[model samples]
Target: MHARDSLDPSRSIWHFIAVHLRRYREAHGMSGQALGDVLDCDRSTVSRYESATLRLKRAHAEIIDRLWATNDMFTNLVDFADRADEGDWLLSLAEFERRATRIRMSDTSVIPGLLQTPDYARATLMAGTADDPNSALERRMSRKAAVFDKENPPRLTAFLGWAVLGQLVGTREVMRDQLAHLIELSELPQVSLRVVEKEAGAHPGLDGPFMILTVDDRDVAYTEAASRGRFLMDPFDIQEVAVRYDLISDIAAPVGPSRALLRAELEKYS
Candidate 1:
């Protein structure tokens, strides 16, 4: 009955670990609660790991290896996955968004993709001269379904720069709908939209956009640049990204005022 039972091990290295971890635990006659005790997490966390909904950390793999006498097989697999190039960065990021228990995004550029309207996304993609602009736009628009159209969606807190709200993307109507969408998403129980006004001025997020996803009690960060994005899994890197988000959040407008600002910006297009 566990969702993990349906996971195809060939999907990714994480999936391979997830499907096999459950099998190994069951073979050893260990209950999820018992395994959770060893992992210093709850039963639900163990279940998430088994479902590959939460990523399995390398340190956890080592611990499992020792506890189960698996001869470091899991450790080696995690190492291999880590050593793999960023070519699969988007795949990993999609997985992170789909399964993250908490997500923090800081953007000083355009509206964060998760909150962008269809036309806004298209405009941005077209402006970028994307390799496959249509496909890219489709993917950007689909994150709403992938990350939100589920039983338990991740709690997302997005901190965006003030310029993002005023800077035009597509057309007046596009910007209007996009700004309206920001307000709409902010009303959700799990979504927080905070705007950092220009008056806030210089800040850590001014450098660029980054995201931190908390999954399986660990944090993974993704930093974006003009061309490529790097996924950061090291504790230090994740902490750095977390610190940056917190700093940016420190200067963001409160929720009520943020909504008021969003509504104010939406009117400009009217």
Candidate 2:
């Protein structure tokens, strides 16, 4: 079956835009190549956009609006989507993480998922909502293998807030094991793990936790919140998150010192 045949418009704003845009084009008896001509791209790109595999940019929406005299509906849809939060971001996250060449992350609340140990992940999962925490734990644990065990794993640069070392997810043993695991991951050539000391004293890094992923030569970002995280696709949004990661990385301890810090914290738990 074709990708668009199974497309669900209600899945996300991106899907909504793609589904409707294709709808409008088909209703007017327009072909993908013709639409691609108006959008100044090749047919495959138009195909991806129409299948909701790629985001439909606001600029493209405006061009379509002008050509079809749709009263800026697509442009307006893009605007609404800009302000909206994408709660269903995990599928996209996994898809992009698999294709990523680089990943930069800054976490203020908990250990970043990719670096988290099983006990630590279990603790965090138990604290949150999960229909089956055990199943969730297994899935959570698989994320590390999924990303790192790939033939060419993405290079990872991670900044963990100092408080995270002492955050106390499960037990002293669990925390200690988690720190030890981090120390090990720090030794990997592909992973550069750092610690961001609290004394850095109030920068935009305090804004929250986020990760920027570089996939297929393009940048995308994910910003987490108390409830749900949002995927950022727009160039400006990606830039802002990149700046946040950079700011935090600047104050973050170097990898060697960060590993030393982890060891020091581990001694405390010992």
Candidate 3:
């Protein structure tokens, strides 16, 4: 499907702006950095705008319209910006987390967000990018505050791939700190940590990692790829994926065995 068709007009204005801007840039053969140069900002700034980290400005929207020679698109974006819900996406996610009585996640690569220490998050972000490592690290660190700062956080049940436990993300000291953090989080009364050992046979989640947030009225499943993240709200799809996740969890190690696995992996880094 085309990128433009993916946008929902009822969503935040930034979402609308980002979709169109990305489409225009791709059509014009303009790399984000090239566009950033035209806008007198850094490449990462362009990325943040696309990611809706930075708010879109009216002037910038006008510039983009002029550059792309779009007749009414610029005016529409400017009007949307004036009354756009500020940080609506993040607010929505935060509300989901807050209202959720339970959060179940299955992760194959990196540590789950609520369990990550700063050092571990830094290492993971750095490994994925060719840009400024510090900036990437900072962005990741900023995201963690939402999960860790709450006084009454949701119950968290996380199943990690054994590879994540075995992988050394940073220096030995950093790795040690990360494991310690995980161990501490696991001890929380509302948290459950499990590991799917490498020896565990094929399972439903072998395809990829995903998270399910169980709120008051419904559940939402989230999946992320290299360049995009999708939130699935359709009840049928969510129900199917939730069933698959449960089967995968059942086939993996139980909580007792998973904690043992984590302890052994921590020793390797120590």
The per-prediction tally of clashing pairs is 0, 0, 0
| Per-candidate TM-score against the hidden true structure | 0.76, 0.78, 0.64
Which candidate's TM-score is highest? 2
lDDT string, candidate 1, 7-120, tens digits = 667767777888889999999999999999998888877887787656678778899999999999989988887677555666667767876788899888898887887888
Candidate 1 segments whose C-alpha is farther than 4 A from its true place: 1-84
> What TM value does model 3 have?
0.64
| Residue pairs whose backbone atoms clash in candidate 1 | none
Report the C-alpha displacement of residue 76, candidate 1, in angstroms.
8.4
lDDT of each: 0.83, 0.83, 0.71
- TM-score attained by model 2: 0.78
Tell me the tens digit of each residue's lDDT in model 2 across 1-270.
565665567666777788898889999889999999889988877887886656888889899999889999999998987777565576556656766789999887799888998899999999998789998788766767779999999999998888888888989999989999999999999999999888887867678888888865567788888767777766788898988887787788999988999999999998
lDDT score at residue 54, model 2, on the 0-100 scale: 69
- lDDT (Cα, 0-100) at 253 in candidate 1: 94
Task: Give the CA lDDT, 0 to 100, for residue 231 in model 3.
Answer: 59
Error of 3 at 247 (Å): 1.0
Name the better of 1 and 3 by lDDT: 1
